[model samples]
Target: AQSVAQPEDQVNVAEGNPLTVKCTYSVSGNPYLFWYVQYPNRGLQFLLKYITGDNLVKGSYGFEAEFNKSQTSFHLKKPSALVSDSALYFCAVRDRADYKLSFGAGTTVTVRA
Candidate 1:
């Protein structure tokens, strides 16, 4: 079975501060990891993906993630948070061969002005 867990329900950060959202996973084989952001009443937008190679992957909007294979974790990070970055985030994973993704419940990121 493949699954992802987002330990935080929400993360609140002030503008210009670093931010992080935790994520852990369990899967039978190599996993295709992905991060997505969703705004109010909108579908999820792709943030980044970790398929292979690099442990540190960068994505849209100054976002990045570190893939820790030994720990089975892929946590999202940003050097400087923004008010516009406040949105719902979801961590997802799929088996090496399967296209069906299993997503975390989601974490709401609230960036204060």
Candidate 2:
């Protein structure tokens, strides 16, 4: 079985400061990690994915993630935060045998002016 954990329920950041959302996972085999952002009343939008390659992967909206296999963690980071960047972020993992992705509870980011 594969599972993902978002340790924090919410992250608050200043408008111009950086932000990070942490995620950890457990899987039987190699894990396929992904990050998605959801706006109010809208579907989740793909942010980035770490399939295979360099440990560092960059994605939409100036977001990047570092895949640390040893730690079983994939944390999303943004150099500069924005008020519009406030939304719900989710970390997901896909198991080799499963066709669907299992998502974390979700982390809500609040950017204060």
Candidate 3:
């Protein structure tokens, strides 16, 4: 089975500090990893994706993620947090065969000033 797990239900960070939201995944074959963010009452926007090759992948809104095959993890990171960055985050993985993405429960990021 293919699935993703976001260990944190919510991550609280002070503005201007770095932030991280943990995620782990399980898949039968090679996984296509993705990160998406959702603002209130809005659709999810793609942050980044780890298709292959690169272990460190950068994406929109100053966000990046490290793909660790051994640990089965892809944790989202940002050097500086902003209040505007507060939102819901989701980790997703596409199955090698079906190419359908299965998403994690989601983690809410709260950046306080």
Q: Using lDDT as the measure, which candidate wins?
A: 1
Which pairs of residues have clashing backbones in candidate 3?
Answer: none
Query: In model 3, which runs have C-alpha deviations exceeding 4 angstroms?
Result: none
Q: Which ten residues in a row have the lowest lDDT in candidate 3?
A: 92-101
**Candidate 3: residue 79 lDDT (0-100):** 99
Model 3 lDDT tens row, 39-83 = 999999999999899899999989999999999999999999999
Ranking by lDDT: 1, 2, 3
lDDT of each: 0.97, 0.97, 0.96
Location of the lowest summed lDDT over 10 successive residues in candidate 1: 92-101
Q: What is the lDDT, from 0 to 100, of the residue 105 in candidate 3?
A: 100
On the 0 to 100 scale, the lDDT of residue 37 in model 1 is 99
- Which one wins on TM-score? 1
Model 2 shows how many backbone clashes? 0
Task: Name the lDDT value of residue 71 in candidate 1.
Answer: 100
